[model samples]
Target: MNSPQTINGLMRHLRNDCKIQISGSYQKQQLTSYGYYHGYKGYRFAGNSYRQIPYSDFSEVVAVIEYDNNLKAALYPELMFIETALKNIVCNESVKGLKLGTFEHLYKERMSDNTTNTKLQSKRLKLRNSVYAKLAARYHDEEEKENQMVRHFYNRGEDAPIWVVFEILYLSDLAGFFECLNEAVRENILKQMNMFDISIDANKNLLSIMIYTLKALRNSVAHNNIIFDTRFKDRKISPVLKKWVEKETGIQNITLYSLIDYIIIVCCLLKRVDFSGTRALTLLNKYKEENQRLQNSVASEIYDHIIQNNVPAKVVGLEAYLNV
Candidate 1:
């Protein structure tokens, strides 16, 4: 039902239908670089099928896409670090507290909580089984023989240690595993991560929520999803931690919908875990650098307009982290 156009035809349609002003060769070069589908079509702001707010210039769309690409590049490494660090902390603490490495032990001692809600218990058991199945498959795979941990566990015939099993678990699985933990075990991991001020119950709940959020973020970054304009589905941060972020960032109305707020959350967790957060700082600096570069370009006003009207307000606090 849809007709295809050449790149130049697409450019003409953008000029005529979208009312975008294509200035010169530079804008055309950008269109060539980013492609028409992603560079132009993706950035359209439409309220309905018939009504659309045209980008003032082609450069505006290019700037937005470039900023998003830069952000994704900068965030990928830091997010990976945070994911690994959180997994390691959870597995180490859970092993010590629960006093077992095997999947059966974890399921029986920690995951098999006596819940009043049968549906909730059933959901958790489903997650547990899924994790077990994945780990078991990975454990027996011939390709995984080179993995020292996998080999060690396979030879032992006992279910793998927390560390070994973690070698195969996705970040989402790790977060789900944390949720399945007994309150005491979860609280121990939280305390170990330096969340001492909060009560054990609050810490357990907060960590569960934060990890879930981080898992979502990690998946997005890992899978090369657009980072800048993403509004998270589960945007609620725990009240106590929300207050802490408000204090730390000096941003009064912090919401997880903003990518900047998510970065701040990652920085907060890194600080709690004593990571120094150098990668987060690098990301903030990179953002500032990109913003500065845009300011010096011919597209400065367009860039400013896009940022002011479209980008998240929490992005303003990115500069503060440079001094930190």
Candidate 2:
């Protein structure tokens, strides 16, 4: 374990060891306010591995941190809304023919068919068992005693309803649950959620893609991870949705793999769910405002680096879309 250091010691390390030029007390004040580990170290990763930064300036690092903070603030509410909407829709559709809280319902109707690929079946069973184990722990634990829904079910000698259990599930857990369901059931849920214009096959494919993408975005936003330049490696974009985004933004190369594409996808989802999308629009505007200073600063190179690695057209198109 490394020895702990005070703020003054950290400031010295930044100036001497890191060779970063500090601008008097203001930078120190920021260090004190946001902490060296979270504020400095988090933004430091944006720099090259050699710890060399543009102009060797500490202010650029501060600018990057502020930009990320604004992004997190702008994204959290919209992502939360999307997560809640998906959970409610999926839970309602999944519990149709069975009692609310029984594992049998999931095994019979929701779990993947065992007759299919043996490896896939084993994987699904593992995921399902993990989820049930988590649920069981929560049910038995007093940690959730104050949760009114849990209390209500416990008092009545009944298991919590599907919706209630869903309340405890993380967005990633919800995505796994969606994946474990039969394709037809997934399509039915999507259709009920106002995705009916597409063919059943297309809808199934789109839902799988969206669930995977949204799960990545939701985890990033919820965990205060950097959102502006995220490129989801595991998510596969639906070609139909990609085409729609390209058409809407008039950007031919909108790949739906970066943060900008994710935002556009969320907007599309909001429209499908009969939401006005005002919050999403507001978030875009906020991001635009917060991002401008960094775009003009040395940190712009960092953004450019991420763009080079991902899709530059989508990143630039998102700014254009927000301005419009």
Candidate 3:
């Protein structure tokens, strides 16, 4: 078992074993403030923890830590807004458009009942079962006592409404439901999301695909996980989705490789939610200033690993779109 060490001991280990030059009058205080596990270990790599970042000095670690802290501060509110907006939009659209608000109605009427396509039918059955399991757990598990929604439904002796179900679902769960929705319903939701267009109408899955792509960053930022290197990106981004962003913003090579691409996604979503382009522009400029701050604080190579060359073009293109 590894022995626990004090801050001084950790600094010694970094110096002697890790060979990192960590020396400053205030570094110990900084270490104390952020802690060894979250501040240093969290910043020790780029993209993956196994791939150790080339940190020649302690200041670089400090730079990364500060950048992450500032990023979370900047993004937390925005994430919350996007999450609530998406849920509200989806729930309202589904209930009003379909003229059905109950879970069972939506599930039975909206889901595929085709016996000819066994695979799709089976897939949909599984999705239905998954939702049932989640609902059962929520109502019967310890959540019944602790969760107000569960308790409310528990007391009523009535099935939880679809809106109530939507309230409890995580963004990932919401994405699953969206993906399984009937094409017309899904496309209508996409139109309400302001993501409606010919390509989306053609490849209707793009809406849910986008939600899945955004899920990682949303969950990570909400949990205060590292994002500067976009290490939280855990899923495959479809080429069609990338092309859509490129077409919308007139920016080429819309790789979700850096943090700025995330901002672009958020900006697009914000636009969909009736937020002015000015608000997104504010976020972009804040990100730009944060980049400059980190650049001034960290080594160039480390900064380059997190922010790529195409980022400036992405920023400019997005800025132009917002300005328009």
The TM-scores of all predictions, comma-separated, are 0.80, 0.77, 0.89
Worst 10 residues of 1 by lDDT: 45-54
Query: What TM-score does candidate 1 get on C-alpha atoms?
Result: 0.80
Higher-ranked by TM-score: 2 or 3: 3
Q: Pick the candidate with the highest lDDT.
A: 3
In candidate 3, what are the lDDT values of residues 17-116, reduced to their tens digit? 8888877759888888888998888888887777787788888888888888788788777777878888887777667655556778888777654447
For model 3, the superposed segments whose C-alpha errors exceed 4 Å read: 49-52, 97-100, 113-115, 141-147, 276-278
Higher-lDDT candidate of 2 and 3: 3
Whole-model lDDT, model 1: 0.67
RMSD of 1: 3.9
Q: Name the better of 1 and 3 by TM-score.
A: 3
Q: Candidate 1: give the clashing pairs.
A: none
TM-score, model 3 to reference: 0.89
**C-alpha lDDT (0 to 100) for residue 115 of candidate 1:** 79
Instruction: Assess the local accuracy of residue 179 in candidate 2 as a C-alpha lDDT between 0 and 100.
Output: 67
Score candidate 2 by TM-score against the native: 0.77
